[model samples]
Target: MSDKKLALVTGASRGIGFAIAERLIADGYRVVGTATSEAGAESLQTKLREHGDEHSALVLNISDSEQTEAALKALLSEYGTPFVVVNNAGITRDNLFLRLNEDDWNAVVNTNLTGVFRVCKALAKAMLKQKAGSIVNISSIIGTTGNGGQANYAAAKAGLEGFSRSLAQEIASRNITVNCVAPGFIQTDMTDVLPETQKEAILASIPGKRFGHVDDIAGAVAFLASEDARYITGQTIHVNGGMNMG
Candidate 1:
């Protein structure tokens, strides 16, 4: 086995997930990033090569139960139990509740909420045996402060946070921590396409008056995954630029 610690990051093809995987690599972990498709996995592997060969990418569609189980089994067999697992894989099905079809709601909830449960369930036993691990689920500010056209997305994210807390309580005695990192409007492809007027409105809402960078969220995840945060669990670290402060 490699001397470096192991970590798994889901939805790591691009955007926030990619940034988190890169950050973990820089922090001296042997990171295994998951993408939804073979093509996405290949692209992720290529992009992450600049960091070094210490990290790898694999195809793992968390939304599919069978695929998730098989992929995770192969992953654990090859790389051993990960000391850190970041549930960053999520999909957004944005639509008003009235117009949102069942398919869209199910897609978002299954992938974003239930998918996380699947990943955590698969790893929990192994981590329990190891008696040392950290689980960081990526949440969104919308989960806490509901959005206009994202009922499904919001509900899923909110459910994620609750699940994290419960899991944290269950595993804390074994030295495993479960926490969340809730990000506000981060500047990604999803937000980049917004109209200038909409962007301005969003910027005005943020106390920082600027969009958050991927690195901002990455930094928080890195912290939660580190020894420094070993005592911290069942809590959320918000990187929302004061957008939804309590």
Candidate 2:
């Protein structure tokens, strides 16, 4: 096995996932980031190459069971097993409950919640054998606070948290930790398109009065994945800038 620690980050082509991958690499791990398309994967590879050749990217569609299995199997065969797994790949199909269709619900739930389940399942056996690992699932503030047009998203994120907690309990004895980092409205592609009026409204509601940088969430994830947080499991560290303090 390589002496360097390995980290697997899903949906890391851009936004929060990309930031987490960058942060983990900076923290001294060889990172493998996943993107849905070849182009995106190439972009991640170029960005991460600055760290080292072992820090690279892969093409993975988490919603597809066959692809998920194959990609993960290939990774395991080549890199042994990742010490850290970050489930950050997700899709948004925002619609009011009354207007939401079955496809919207299925797409969001399948990709966000079930996708994480699949990835975790694929990697769990290796983690069990290693007797050490960290799994951080990226959750959303909408999961707890709820939202007007994001019932599907909220449900999916909320399910991810529950899944993380249960998995944490099951793996705790083996020194494997499962936790969640729930981000509020961080500045990303999803939030960047908001109209100025809507953006102002959101800013006014937040106690910080400013949008959070991607690095804010990345920092929280990096901490949870480190040895310092070995005792902390089955919990969520919210990085929401006081949007919904509880």
Candidate 3:
């Protein structure tokens, strides 16, 4: 095994997750990115191999407890234990509360909130034993600001922040840090489909007058995962380009 620290990033096939994985690899970590499908995993492996052959990808469906457990075990067995874990895998089913079905609510809650819980639970065993690690969870502006049609998504993200704070307290004595990176309007596949008028409105609201890049959020994650942020824990870093300032 390489002497470099191992980092695991979930939902890393594309967008923000992929960028975080790339940044970690550049920071001298041997990254293992996860995707929901085999094809996506293969693509992640190919893209990361450009950085180095030491990087790898796994098929992980965080909503599936059995599959998630097995994947984590396999990764641990192969790469030992990861020094950093990025819980970036999340899904959205946007709808007004009255219109939201049970399935939609359950799916969003399971994948976004509970899914993160599972990933952290599996990592805690190894990290607690090692007595050193970092966990960064990706949250959203909607979680704090509360959009009209995103009840489920907002709840899940809000729950994530609470979970991070509680977990940080639980593991701080072990030198394991848990924090959150809450992003605003980042340009991604999900945002690309917005109507031109909607995009303009979003741009006008941001003090920066522009959407954030994937690299912007990636940089925040990298900082929290690095020794530079050792003294920081149980806090949320908002990378929202002045969209929602305290």
Which predicted model would earn the best lDDT?
3
lDDT of 3: 0.95
Give me the displacement of residue 18 in model 2, in angstroms: 0.8
Worst 10 residues of 3 by lDDT: 118-127
- Per-residue alpha-carbon lDDT of model 2 for 1-246, expressed as tens digits? 557899999999889998999999889898999999999999889998977887888999999999999999999998889999999999999888999999999999999999999999999999999999999999989999999999999999999999999999899999999999999989988788999999999999899999999999999999999999999999999887799998
> lDDT at 204 for candidate 2?
90
The alpha-carbon root-mean-square deviation between model 1 and the true structure, to one decimal in Å, is: 0.8
Candidate number with the higher TM-score (2 or 3): 3
lDDT, residue 97, model 2? 95
**Candidate 1 residue lDDT tens string, 13-64:** 8999999999999899998999999999999988887787867889999899
Clashes of each: 0, 0, 0
The order of the candidates by lDDT, greatest first, is: 3, 1, 2
Candidate 3 lDDT, 1-246, residue by residue in tens: 899999999999999999999999989999999999999999999999999999999999999998999999999999989999999999989888899999999999999999999998887899999999999999989889999989999999999999999999999999999999999999999889999999999999999999999999999999999999999999999999999998
For each candidate, C-alpha RMSD in Å? 0.8, 0.9, 0.7
Model 3 error, position 73 (Å): 0.7
What is the descending TM-score order? Answer: 3, 1, 2
Question: How accurate locally, in lDDT, is each candidate?
Answer: 0.94, 0.94, 0.95
Worst 10 residues of 1 by lDDT: 46-55
